[model samples]
Target: MTASTPSELIARSRRLGADPRNTNYAGGNTSAKGTGIDPVTGEPVELLWVKGSGGDLGTLTEAGLAVLRLDRVRALVDVYPGVQREDEMVAAFDYCLHGKGGAAPSIDTAMHALVDAAHVDHMHPDSGIAIATAADGEELTSRIFAGKVVWVPWRRPGFQLGLDIAEIKRQNPQAIGCILGGHGITAWGETSEEAEANSLWIIHTAEAYIGEHGRSDPFGGVRAGYEALPQAERRAKAAALAPTIRGLASTDKPMVGHFTDSDDVLEFLAGEKAADLAALGTSCPDHFLRTKVKPMLLDLPAGASVDASIARLTELHEQYRADYRAYYDAHADASSPAMRGADPLIVLIPGVGMFSYGANKQTARVAGEFYVNAIHVMRGAEALSTYTPISDAEKLRIEYWALEDAKLQRMPKPKSHQGRIALVTGAASGIGKAIATRLAAEGACVVVADLDLEKAQSAAAELGNADVAIGVAANVADADAVQAALDATLLAFGGIDLVVNNAGLSLSKPLLETTEQDWDLQHDVMAKGSFFVAKAAARALIAQGMGGDIVYISSKNSVFAGPNNIAYSATKADQAHQVRLLAVELGEHGVRVNGINPDGVVRGSGIFASGWGANRAATYGVKEEDLGQFYANRTILKREVVPENVADAVYVLTGPELSRTTGLHVPVDSGVAAAFLR
Candidate 1:
């Protein structure tokens, strides 16, 4: 019945890892033991495939599962008899690796190797941990699970803990699983399926028992009216507070704030017991490593003025950090390295939802997600009975664990734009999409904004990393929509560092033939839209007190008027002038405004998709197919200009290359004499 291959074990690991409810990000590890041919020696050996440290179970692959010699890992129990040997045990785990190259196995590899079952799954399920971390956790497990499970007291995970687990399993040979008090749950069986089923059954049984016996709906009548607001309004409120939160959270190094006002967040914030519930600490000890042991509860007055609100939050943030320092001093081990900064990772602002802070948007977003999960776990535990979690002392141990800190220290250095955030409008396709793609590649988290909501979402998804991009629907013509897009960027990424004002449309009609509607539409989107986006972004950058870049996508027509392109050319000309004006006004704030005037990007561009390419070719008495070559030949270089060419110009302006330059026009037109900047 045992798993004959590692594939089933990998599948089982993924199934549990995929759900945050089952395994909070990187909080669980799984292992399967079987005989395999050693790569170094052509002899049969018992190998244990355990989830490696730093790999998420949800996205786990075979490579992520480290192959260790079972016998080698098990022998480490004797290497440090009676003493906690976390450092030596980690080295032993590395030494036990069966292959030449792969990630180091999870720190719990010893425990996995000692277990009698061939397949074992360990995870911090919210439902299970709620019972496991209770003050009377052992009694609860005995009363509910009875002979089906055994309860083990909290032990720091190490070689000693592995030996303890081995002894418990030896004593209770018939037990299907073990509930580690104040830690998590472990399930095992001869086969992967049985182990997985046993894990699910324990979680479902605990959840069902809680549902039957827990207090009825403590948060039932709480008002969540904030969530009912229009998307624009909701985002505006979030954006209004983001800069202040970011400023308040700042330490020696800058910190970014990510806001989440989802229904769950709103409900949790709206609850009468919100403060009391958050004070209970995280449901699982591992969460303390991400979000601190507990979150800061901010008293955000409803009708306070912006300045008053910022001042109040600033005081609260300082107080929170002071309180954190006290907590650390109360429980910190003298031998532990200097405590990390006392800044709160998760901040709960009643009536405003939650904000999680980190050095960049991705880390902030992950902290926010952990807080959201913590809320769910805490609420469930409270409904059943009084909620209890691991003590502050236990959280201190986990937070400063040498093994975890070592893993972080080993991570590769970040890219050039690692912590920066970029927003690209009209990113659904063409030049905007290219710009977004480039920014993401360069390690900046990107917000894809476009009039087409579905296309924007699809484009963001196509960027291929969920943490690197988000999509928001925004019509550049509407000032409200422009603000909403910026707000969305702030909410998703903490703040905006680079704003690409690239959304525009073309009208290829002569001045005599152009209608009022055509002129208005072109001006509204191209000229006014650029102005609105630049102005809003500048305001945010000034508030952030951080220098920023605003790159506008102008047209070559801005400098050289084409014969039947009055509306498009005129609007683009206005956009170019607006950029210069923005540069002059925002320079004092350390914000730079620049433009890229790209010419005849007929292929793989929105202009062609919107029929402007055919119109221009027809006006020039050429076939539609010849438009690209025609434009390429028009330039002195006689080379076709692609969307990437325009995007490169934007990068140059926004990046360090043009730091001192502003109010400048960079032409991507392959040396057109008349269109050259004077």
Candidate 2:
């Protein structure tokens, strides 16, 4: 059997895309051309299979490859007026697709089709970009890959770029690849293997040239001692600095923040010339689209208090915004769209590391990853020579490009709670886990907190969306731990919109048999813990000036007495009363507090997992296996309470349905008359 036409090309694309050093998430394109029978005419014709726009090459499938008639795409070159018409070009490219199943062809489809070779690979490899974007890029290109590669000056990518590449090819038919100044590199070959090999050779050759000729002391300074701190302490430090950064970066729309303390980030921040390099520009144009043109440099003095940091960040942010507006006013054309919010997407702090902010976690992480890659490229470029990238004016054009804006405008609509953040306590398993999962499913970023760090992380992993949920180890009974947990939440997701106080232990004992330790543990977790978390969350919400929700998971014992449950009953009642008081006190700040009273949730619950179900069953003279049925019979509706039942009630209270309702109690006990709300 003959080998497939584009399978080798797809394999090569995946190989290159799989490595961030080669391409930063969805940032490159690949193509292959071969003779195939036309589906409609059943005649042999040239077919170009190119990577589709907005698809990641690392995960690209055959469906993601847009098949276009090579002759049809190449013919546009003759009639196309040499003007900047990205919109028309995109429409024309889409119109040329040979089938309806594939997505729109890549913006660079014309350039790929014009290449004489049967296969082409174009990527923003860090090594190639480092060499291609340097101060003397053309001179260095000739010195490194003489005769084998052609150097093309930077031009805005479109019909004109395609024509330029064709002209370059005409001048040098033996050229294996071309380096686009301040952009990226392109390599071509007669086969997919040859193309991939040539691309790797160019990249590795550039890397080797830099390694031999680059500066030895690119980092400028020794590693800081703070970088050697324990992971927990480092995280806490990052958390301490997060609220200030988030507050400063907030614009018309709030931003979510992600902090990084990797060795690459720490080393980059430690460099003496870091500030100067960061100010130059992004390593490539695509990076500018994600992380702005440059990152904001922050100076965090040694041992600065949280308040001092906040004040400093706030002042610096005001100045940054002012400078950004000035830049916009200086360069914005009459046709340019209104300027976006003047907040830096990336922020670099000396001791704490870097923070990337976005409208959500995914965007923020993308910016962070790109910056991390930039660090490597920048260092490599600086070592070889003075690191130089595209000019600020060129970056601004790409940033405000009409076509780029349209891509964002075309995205699907966001969910109801798209940007909201929630913190759920004791979320490693059971009721808390259910609540956390539900909140995430509803489009809210969630912090899954528990006393067990491993279990908490496991629960978060099970949610399977790292961008939407994170795990933190917190013991609600300890005020410091609770505060740290809250800070971590703010650092990870920007702000908290909802607080679920659901971490509690079940203590069902006779009043005389209850030990002091048991009494203290119950009150510490159920009463004092709830108060601490709520107070911390309320303060944050008040600071944000955004109204929020606080839901307490109380029990039926708060309203109806149960035998031998004195301590539990007392604490539950205290928690219920605390909700009412908090509702009244926080009302002015637009913070709502409510309670959910669930009678018996025996399965998949921590209380039951720790033998509480059997204990309660023993107290009622019933078998442990029959406990669920016994409780179901006790309720008027004759139904057993489940974790999901409570989760649904909590959702209703936290969602828009109860926006005007507060200081109220909702019962999820399958219709228990005695525990019913008055």
Candidate 3:
């Protein structure tokens, strides 16, 4: 067994963090002590490299490693100001930095540095915490661990806890690690391989012990009427409640939400002790950081009607907020940070499942995952003995610690459109795609809705992962298809905020040459389609009680009265008027409707690529390939209006700069005096 490099430590961490059963997401730390040449003195210097704060071990990298001089870090032991002043050590780590300091050191830095080992791993695995949280955790650890792992009673993580564990290791020479009472676990060794193996041994041993001796039904068996409903009913109920729940959770600030109906959640929610354990809340620091001190549990059983559940949810929500504020008031001191938020991140319903919210989709999803891990911890602990967690007062201490306050202060500022959900029709290509891309770039979760499901999916993948964008199939001409797309939006990222009605096609023909089928097709997809999208979106916006935006991608032809374009022109005109009508009607509800008028978006356009380019070219007596330049030449500025230009107008209308300016048409055709909204 010998010391290793930072990469070795990261590799070991990734292996251990790969499974949630081993550690919760972003909830563990790993470290290694090594020697490197000092650049200035040309002498060897011992260095401590550990996983930095707020980073997931599974995705660790060189930049995510915090580097400090081992001697400087260990020297703090002499100046130790006791447990109350231990938090100051985190700020002191910056002074011990070997060079650029790398990433910010976590509160666990002392735990890794003070311990007498070349390699160490600290994790929040459910199985380990299950033993750790049991009422008789010390006795349980002695028996289940075969006298190898010691029990370090719960102490909020900081410098003092690290010193205590290091002393425990020195006293027990044969110990590999210790179960952190009411916390998690820590394992250490002389080498990377030894350290990782010891961690797995502890985690697996606890799991096996719980399996062999624990009760078969620790959660007190399933309660009648709390069992999960049929799949379809469950899904429908979730969709119906998601928007209202999202709005309530966003009382502090708007949040994106994630819903889970996994077997773990449903099973836990149906158990007789589900309400009791959930109310008791999570034990681990990482778990509570995301899940909060407690979840908002619905009083109704699984058999309750959707309407009754929603109605009761509103009442429970108010009580939850009041209780949270009381907790803050009881524990807050003059030095404590102002209450971060009163809204619960996790919400539980007996029949449906769990919903978690955060500033973004991935965050919201991760919060739910942390809560699931807590459930496992509770189940295992209850099987062994009475499940007990650290006191709420200690929780308040950690939650309001100044170090955490500084960490929050250091987070990157929110994007202009962060937490917004946008649904853009015809978003698979051209102007619609450009709009979706810009909205996502500005930090909105986008739904790429298009008739071509495959292309829509491809475009969404290019934008980003599920957190930023998702593709939904929809034919705007069909009302049911449009509703389905909106439904998908709700299920994915909660309620909708911005709706871009951009699905349209153009057919160039003289009044005499235009056929009845041509008129219907244009009207159906553009005029009626815009109406349906706005109507459905408005309903959701009103239900959420959150103001929103609806931007119609009308055409410059709507006002230009251009020749050989009667059907296409009429539909655009109809869309433009609908925007004005809706804007005036929905003003009271804070829903602003606007229109973007652009002329001749030829390149990369789905409509143009599908033969509208050649048709308009022939109608205007220009070559098919020259159509774009020809249209550009007709504009006063003589600049081609591409899809991106139209997208820019959409942002302006919906962004904060023009928030109060609704029902206004912005022309993106370089300069079309005839098409200007007079």
What local lDDT score does residue 435 receive in model 2, on the 0 to 100 scale? 94
At residue 150, what lDDT does model 2 achieve?
A: 87
Q: Write the per-residue lDDT of candidate 1 for residues 464-500, one digit (tens) a residue.
A: 6667898999898999899888888888777778999
Q: Write the per-residue lDDT of candidate 3 for residues 191-243, one digit (tens) a residue.
A: 89999999999999999999999998999989999999887788778877888
Judge candidate 3 at residue 656 and give its lDDT. Answer: 86
Q: Pick the candidate with the highest lDDT.
A: 3
User: Model 2 misses residue 141 by how many Å?
Assistant: 0.8
Error of 1 at 49 (Å): 1.5
Of the candidates shown, which would achieve the greatest TM-score relative to the real structure? 3
Q: Is candidate 1 or candidate 2 better by lDDT?
A: 2
Q: Give candidate 2 regions above 4 Å deviation.
A: 1-3, 219-234, 300-303, 487-495, 536-547, 587-590, 618-623, 633-638, 656-661
Give lDDT tens digits, candidate 2, residues 472-510.
999999999999899889777767889999999877799
The TM-scores of all predictions, comma-separated, are 0.89, 0.93, 0.98
Q: How close is candidate 1 to the true structure, as a TM-score?
A: 0.89
Lowest lDDT 10-mer window, candidate 2?
A: 222-231
